[model samples]
Target: MSVLRLVLGDQLSDDLSALKDLNPDVDTVLMAEVRDEATYVRHHQQKLALVFAAMRNHAERLKGRGVNVRYVRIDDADNSGSITGELARALDDGAHEAVVMTECGEWRLAEHLAAFAEGAGLPVEIREDRRFISSHDRFRRWASGKSQLRMEFFYREMRRETGILMDGDQPEGGRWNYDAENRKKLAKGVTPPDRLLIPPNAVAREAMGDVERLFGDHFGSLDGFGWATTAEEAEASLKHFLKDVLPSFGDWQDAMAEGQPWMWHGLISTSINLGLLDPLDVCKRAEAVYRAGKAPLNAVEGFIRQILGWREFVRGIYWLKAPEYRARNFLDADRKLPWFYWSGETDMACVADVVKTTRDNAYAHHIQRLMVTGNLALLLGVHPDQVDDWYMCVYADAYEWVEMPNTRGMALFADGGIVGSKPYAASGAYIDRMSDYCGACRYDVKSKSGDAACPFNRLYWGFLERNRGRLRDNVRLAMPYRTLEKFGEAKRKALAAEAEACRTLLGAAPME
Candidate 1:
């Protein structure tokens, strides 16, 4: 009995259950760098490089372990352009059945594989992806009969189930979330923690070149790419985070610094999302830090929530409302994504810094993502598709499943109130409080309308006015509604025009 076990770029686990019962003598493992996957979203150059290099490294690891591994590189002479094409070519050599672990993210890819399996007329076994703490069935059960889904409640349930931060069945410190304490910015003269940097080897460098040449016309830059490509390097990066950075990770997790891109951010998203590190293991490791009395309760708890709570919950929401989930557009915003999104030429310093960092490194922390780039896109009325694709392409951790919900629901409020109850729309004040980018910014964060006033401040009100009819029912938007009423028609029109003018200045420069 011969089996062909397929591994996706993100599914590089050595101990995948599908391989558990594999008769090595008869089983063959398959991995490929398909054009279909890369071009589907016009991903960042570094993203393509990292995934290909990581996949190549994983394939080598499997081969070294004596598994019959077959790898098809993107530039292979006989390569097929898609996953199914490669799979069909592999099947022609006579494989009785196929064993595949479920896809980590992206419903579209999963559907493609399922349809391919059916077309092949083989008993395709789709194994559950056990890497996550929350299962599909568990999410289904949790969401069943729920009128409104809230992350806080779901997070509490997870705390009980996992026994994390629990003291004899009660939450530690008598609280489930320490978000209030976690929101503090770095004090004056406080030095930020150093981040781990994995210098690319020859293979990754070559892959980077390939990506640059292929995706030259795409958004984001290829300069300053440094990401762990192998499992060993990924594990080392995680250990470094636990030892050096995790202590103050909570305080600065949401903080942004001007000219400083990696302010205590765990750059482990790419590695974790790529399957080099497991999220459960990451939580357990963070918990160990608390048990060892090395990291504070707030720091450990905050880190744990991102992985165990938010990460898992988002995955559940994605599966629960998928297919229809992609089409959800609560706000019905129709503006094209401003050219500045790609150029990073905006006058807003926070936007400039984050976008510049993204263009340079293909990375940014969640706060920089949500409150900075994502916030501007939503407030400025960039079309959801444009915003969604930009996010999906620019970030290293982005995949369709995670990026879509976080962008559409949390950032753009496109899903009305599914992933987030209300839009995370905010004036420049939020950026002023959270980041130093505003201090040196050309645009005044305080001003709502003048030429030197921050476009975000003006656009913030403009967004509320534009969406009042759609979002007026949301109780959370009441304050903004009142503020909009105070502005009246004339001021609102002037502000919208200023914002539109600012948007027009984007992408006026020639591409380098």
Candidate 2:
């Protein structure tokens, strides 16, 4: 039978299941750059360029190997502007008897494709995407009866199942996690090594131009665009991280510095999510460094956990409880996202820096993402819909499968306690301890009540006080609740007032 195999932009791996039993003569690999997917969120300009460039490069590679690839450019004259429309266009020729594709990454797209498959002229087979450590069935089995789907416990299962960092049923170094060892702040005068920027090739430059012509009003800049656009370039970038950056990654994985956005990070998430780099292969490579004594256990283990544990765990949660999970708002945070999130026009140095980096590089390290942007949004009680849309629109590595759980569950705690036991809510002290931004900020990090005090401090207390009915019973937040209880009712009320004032300063007010 002649099969038309569909390859989504993110599914660029050569060994993708949809192409497992390909026939070069009769089977065609269908790849399209659809407008529906690109404009779904007004994504970062660089993100659009990166995916299209990577897709084009992967298509070329397949063609080089004599594979029949039916490629569709975003600007094609007869482009249908949607994936389902493109599929219908392809089937009009009656050139194939069956359609095969790996399941998609996002629920939005998955639902669209499922509905299309029900009435398509030919049989459709949506095969499992084998790129992840956990399948839908595997995650369902693990989360079957559990009351709380903690990532730590889920990570342990992945470690044992993959035998990564394992020494015959025991974790290497007699520990399953090195998170405590990985929280050191960046020491003064200890400059982070420079990140390697891969120049855009002709193919990438063309994709970048197309995104600009089509999406000039998108969220981010196209200048200084240096993401690797092919599997070969991605592998080179990974090797650079393993050799030069991985050694110091552990000590300052959570650290932030002024004027330094790429703080000892791997910078490979875009590649991994794009299927240019395999997650398991990347984890094993980091593990190999520990075995060879080239990198420390803390660094290797910390990095591996991000991919094998946290990355996989979030994907599972996204699929396991999505469509409804997207609307969850445990705190009923209804305020609009502050304007500075896009403009980097805030006096708060940490937020401005993170927004600037996100605008310029289409990237930021985890600390910048979590404690700075995400934390502030949580404290501000911005609606999950607004926060979720901003994240999906801004980051290059973001897709709904990975980004939603990280934003709603881990960052915002909108899912209550599904992905985390407690809200990651924190005061200015956490940022001051981890970053250099507070030193130059207009507001004092130490002051609590006055306008001169950092907004995060007041907002931190206010977030807890406002959500006390929901969060006070949480075991992890007991100490904070105890401290708040000692603050007297008057002090608690004052904290909430100050937080509202700060919100006004940031150009947002309490939701009506």
Candidate 3:
């Protein structure tokens, strides 16, 4: 029987699992730009455009390869505004006898598609997404007896399994990680290498116009929309990163600079997450660069670890614990997100820079996301749901599988140390050591109290003081708790009061 293969916006690869066994003559590939997915989170305008344009381009490429495709535009006259609605309409039109789709990256959409399949009165098959090196079941077996699921241990096993950087069962250069060497601050007077930016083509322009007409008031701007919208463009981007930026990527991957949003960072996550670039392929290329003496071990290993290790590990944790995982707010953080998160109206130079970069580019490096914005949210005690929603909405690369784990587990420590052993709570001094933002800020990073103090310094102690009962026993946080104890009651109270005033100024509610 002929099949209707459903391809999601992020599942744009030609070798996608659902399309692997496709009989081009009998199967009809179904791609849709549904309002349900786009409006689900008020995604950034550039994010919407990028996905829509990529999907359009992928469908056209499939047609060129002689595969029958049924494409639905968001503004189609008979569009039902949802994935299930569109699928049902397609089924009723009697184009195919069975439905086939690769499992989606999100729980909400996965559940909806599963329900539609059961009710569609047709044969349905949901294939495992084989895009990653680790399968869901394989990851589950590896996690079956572990007390703690740590990415480091999982990464070692992945190295052994793939033999990517393995030297006959041992890691290359006598180490599995080069993270320590990857934390150097940007060198003074040294400029970041320029990155390749793919201008929006006609297809991307139409997609942008659609998003502007539909979601103009969304949280981000589309003025500088230059993300890769096709597999070819994504490949070109990878080549550019390997050649120009990978050498310095390790040295400054954790550093942030004023007005330098793309400082030696690979801008390929959106394309990889969208299936325009293969993760494994990208990792191998980085490895090859190292083999050819083009980049250092720190650069290559760090780059590979992000894709092969963290990326796969997060997907595993998301699938293993999700639905219930989304509600895990171990910190009991209930404060609302600050308004400046969306508006970039804050006087905090570090935060304002990150937010402005997000608004303009729909992107930020991991440190800017984790230390600046995510750290601020965690210290301010923003609710996990609000934090997850904001992160999911603003980044082009964000999907629930990846964003949820990073936000709730790593960033907020909302999962009670499931993803991170400790809350990434830090004083402004950490940022001062890593970036140039402190030099230009109105508040003093050196100050620990009062109105002109960096809010991070005040909130750092306040978070520890407030969560001591829950976090004091954590070994990783022992020193911070001990330091808090040394501060005595008076100093702690003063810090708490200062933090409260800072939160109030930011329009966040005082901790109850």
Candidate 4:
């Protein structure tokens, strides 16, 4: 019997489970640019262009291999604007006996597809997504009896299971993490190696035009759009990273510079998340580079941990604790996100710089996401939903499985201590140490209180004082809480008042 195979925008790999058993002549690969997925959270214009271009390219590659592919453009006259609607319309035409699809990344889409299958009265086979190193069952088995799921432990297990960076039975360099060595501040007169910018091919240019015309009012700019939209281009980008950027990646990975958005970063997450590159393959190549004495162990290990460790860990947590996980507001933060987040109109140099980069490229490195925008939101008590939505909408690599845990758990501490051992809360001091943005900032990063003080400075202490009841017992926060006690009630009140004034100036209503 003939079958219909479905491909999501992110599932662009030729080896995707849905296409493994394909009969090129009988099976029609169904790919659609649905409006529902595109406008789910008002995604950035560049994100829209990248996904669409990549999807289009993947479809053409399939067709060139003698596969019958039914591709639906977003602006098609008869387009149904929803995945389920498109699938139902296609099935009703009676070309295929059944529907076959690989499992989707998002819970919402997965549930919708499953329901559609049941309602349509057709035989549907949903295959496992094998692109990731760890399967859901494997992750669940690893986490079954554990009281607390720490990424470090999970990462160690992944290394043992995959034999990546392992010296027989032991870890390379006698350690699983090189994160400590990865925190060096960027030295003066030192610059990151030049990045290879992939120019927009004809397909990408068309997709860019479509995004500009259709999603003009989206959050990000479509100018200077340069992302790999196919597997070949993505592989080339990875090779460039291995050759030029990997050596210094560990030392300066956390360092941020003004007008240098891509500093020592791989910039391949968009491609990897889009199924253009396999995570295991990327990790192995980095290991090979280290083995060859090209890239340092710290840099290679740090890079490998991001994919084999954090990337896999987050996906596992998402699947393990989703649906309810999305509603988690452990801190009870109810404040609305400030308008400056979208407009990049803040006087805080760090926040503005990160926001501008996000708007321009649909990306910001981990440190910028974690310590700057994410840290400020945590300090200011922005609601978890607001924080999650902003993160998911702005980044090209942000699929819900990865974005939610990073935003709600790691960034905002919204899940309490599930994804992270402690809140990633810090004052302006942390920002000043890691980035040069504080040097150009209008507010004084050193000032602890008052109008001229950085908002982060006041908000840090204010957050500690405000949340002492919930966080005081935690061992990790004991020192900060003790310091708050040493400040006495009068100093605490003053700090709170300073935070209130700063929030008022920024037009953020106080969180109850």
In candidate 3, how many Å is residue 461 off? 0.5
Candidate 4 clash pair list: none
lDDT of 1: 0.83
**lDDT by residue for model 4 over 1-512, one digit each (tens)?**
89999999999987999999999878999999999999988999999999999999999999899999999999999999999999988887888998999999999899999899888787999999999999999999999999899999999999999999999999998988989998977899998788997898899999999998999999989886889999999999999999999998999989998888999999999999999999999999999999999999999999999999999999999999988999999999988899899999989898899999999989899999999999989988899989899998999899999999999999999999989988999998888888888888899999987878888988898888888888999899999999999999999998788877777777677545
Instruction: For model 3, state the Cα shift of residue 287 in Å.
Output: 0.6
Q: Compared with the true structure, what per-residue lDDT tens digits does model 3 show for residues 318-421?
A: 99998899899998998989999999998899999999999999999999999999999999999999999999999999899999999999999999988888
Q: Encode model 2's per-residue lDDT on 444-467: one tens digit a residue.
A: 999986778899997888888889
Worst 10 residues of 4 by lDDT: 503-512
Off by over 4 Å in 4: 510-512
Per-model lDDT: 0.83, 0.93, 0.92, 0.92
TM-score of each: 0.95, 0.99, 0.99, 0.99
Expressed as tens digits, the lDDT of each residue in 409-489 for candidate 1 is 888888889888989988889888887778888888888776788877767766777787898878998877877778788
Model 2 accuracy (lDDT, Cα): 0.93
Clash pairs, model 1 backbone: 330-414
The clash tally of candidate 3 reads: 0
lDDT computed for candidate 3: 0.92
Q: Which scores better on lDDT, 1 or 4?
A: 4
Give the worst 10-residue stretch by lDDT in candidate 2. 503-512
